[model samples]
Target: MRMCDRAGCDQPGNCPAPKSPNSPERWYFCERHAAEYNSNWNYFEGLDKEEASAREQAERAEGASYRQSSWNAWAGPGDGSRSRDELRALEVLELDPDADFDAVRKAWRSKAKLVHPDVRPGDEAAAKEFQKLQVAYEVLRAAEERRTWKGPEGTF
Candidate 1:
């Protein structure tokens, strides 16, 4: 087990935290240390309130692509098991909440063909729509793969 990176702490480090803003390096911390670190963490500690707000707004807009899909309209009642983002993917594909893999595949194929960049070259809207569709398909496909995956020979 990895030891917590905090000075003088001796515990299994299960939580990985970034060492600095946007840095690739990470520091591992035990649960207690991780909580302590997060309690004092700030995303815009150095920026003024206006700058921080602007930066936050920009980041939200930049990350809004997947969130803009149809799934936002049909987010399931909060049970905390399924994320809003995952439900958004289902909305993008126009599938029922409990749709099977086959249904997901069919919806993806039909939707993707309409907004393919090649089919609408120079159309920015089409390109963006295609990107959203692609993201949605990938999310659902990955979930399906995880559900159907089998570990080596009866071990799972």
Candidate 2:
């Protein structure tokens, strides 16, 4: 009988969770610990919106090609163009799903100014909201940059 991978647990290791996204390695845990690990895990921890979108597209392309999909169908974000994080960012800035990058920048500047730590000194709640807005803006900006990047002009 295999022992649970979680420290100090003597339960039988029956459930498996990937140690990291796209990794073959797994953590064998009892059912409870597996749930705990999954709840705490961020499957897209290091991925930006653009990377996520690309990955989703590739998966869909593979599906369209009728390849043996070991991973099953993907539950993509809204309209299959934006990532969940990007959607959340749009919500933060009160923008529509198809809003342009310029709109994102304008909204970010307007909202960030209201909750900025420098403007509202000593207010923990405002500081936290400001930080949230900053992260949302960054995610949107990076996605926009990625969308516009043209690498090396198609070398022959």
Give lDDT tens digits, candidate 1, residues 32-60: 99999999898799999999999999999
**All predictions: root-mean-square deviation over Cα?**
17.4, 12.1
Residue pairs in collision within model 1? none
The digit string of per-residue lDDT tens for model 2 on 1-156 reads 998999999999999888878899988999999989988887557899999889889888877633311112132223456778899999988998878788889999999999998899999999999988999999988876655555586311
Candidate 1 Cα misplacement greater than 4 A, ranges: 1-82
TM-score of 2: 0.50
In model 2, state the lDDT of residue 106. 93
Error of 1 at 19 (Å): 40
**Separate clash counts for every candidate:** 0, 0
The whole-model lDDT of each prediction reads 0.78, 0.79
Least well predicted 10-residue stretch by lDDT in candidate 1: 70-79
Assess the local accuracy of residue 75 in candidate 1 as a C-alpha lDDT between 0 and 100.
37
* TM-score on alpha carbons, each prediction: 0.47, 0.50
